[model samples]
Target: MSESFELADADRLTVGTVGPPGHRVFYLQAGEAGRTITLKVEKQQVAVLSQAIAELLADLRAPEAIAAAGELLEPVDPLWAVGGMQIAYDQDDDRLILVAQELLAEEDADEDDAAVGRLRFTREQAAALVARGEELVEAGRPPCPWCGYPLDPAGHSCPRTNGHRPPTP
Candidate 1:
């Protein structure tokens, strides 16, 4: 009952974001024949996807795929927001396949308005996406020294402080 879309040979495929480093929204975008499809995604999803792609590529018989610098990631209006995400390797085609399900409210779980999409990308394209993901993740708030939690602009309340003033060092 849900809608579906597939981009088998996307001319452009990459993970992108909107807004500043700490307040950004992640998205997965694919383009072909002047048309583009965008799906909302979580930052953690991007990180996982990037690592998954890298690992999958490493296991392939093909040579390692390294992302070239300065690749451009264009923006697109999300056709549908995404919730669950999945990835697979298509050995026959030598492609990385990604699938995303539309974001749904708890009450709407049984509704038929859900959207599902599949995108296939070459090793090169997948590697490029991973590179961008790494950059975006690192651009966020820096981690605290005492604890590994990310430091907010106002600073994190380090548990190691035991309610005392956080160590300056």
Candidate 2:
């Protein structure tokens, strides 16, 4: 377990750990005094988001890539979405802090903007493209436009190339 647990408020989100030996946990603490709707979060969601973070850090450390991974979590439950979450890395303390919030429906614009900026594709558009690609694969036909010139498991040998021979097994 990481040292610190993330924290958040309606106005802002914060991530920080208390220090070593602390276990990561998620909760929906009550607001000020009395609130009709309480905040919500799940430990599983945090685990999922953490995996996304690891993936984002695998190849490159670009801010845009980080933002893209954050975008992928947009449709995820707001309480667990890491968009606004802050990460604090303290080697000496051996702690990591991550903050998040459960945005209200009125805040959809913020979520939309974040996702569009990263993927350059709306949710609907992405879904359609995926569906089309799946159809092509299922039919064992030529690759879709997006895939372009599919390759064999071994090496590629396409007769369509200039003066090329037919593909051989």
lDDT of each residue in 109-137, candidate 2, tens digit only: 45433321011222222223223323322
Please report the candidate that would top TM-score against the real structure.
Answer: 1
Tens-place lDDT digits, model 1, residues 104-154: 888888646778898887888877887888887788778778877777776
Q: Pick the candidate with the highest lDDT.
A: 1
Estimated TM-score per prediction? 0.82, 0.22
lDDT of each: 0.77, 0.30
Model 2 poorest ten-residue lDDT run: 65-74
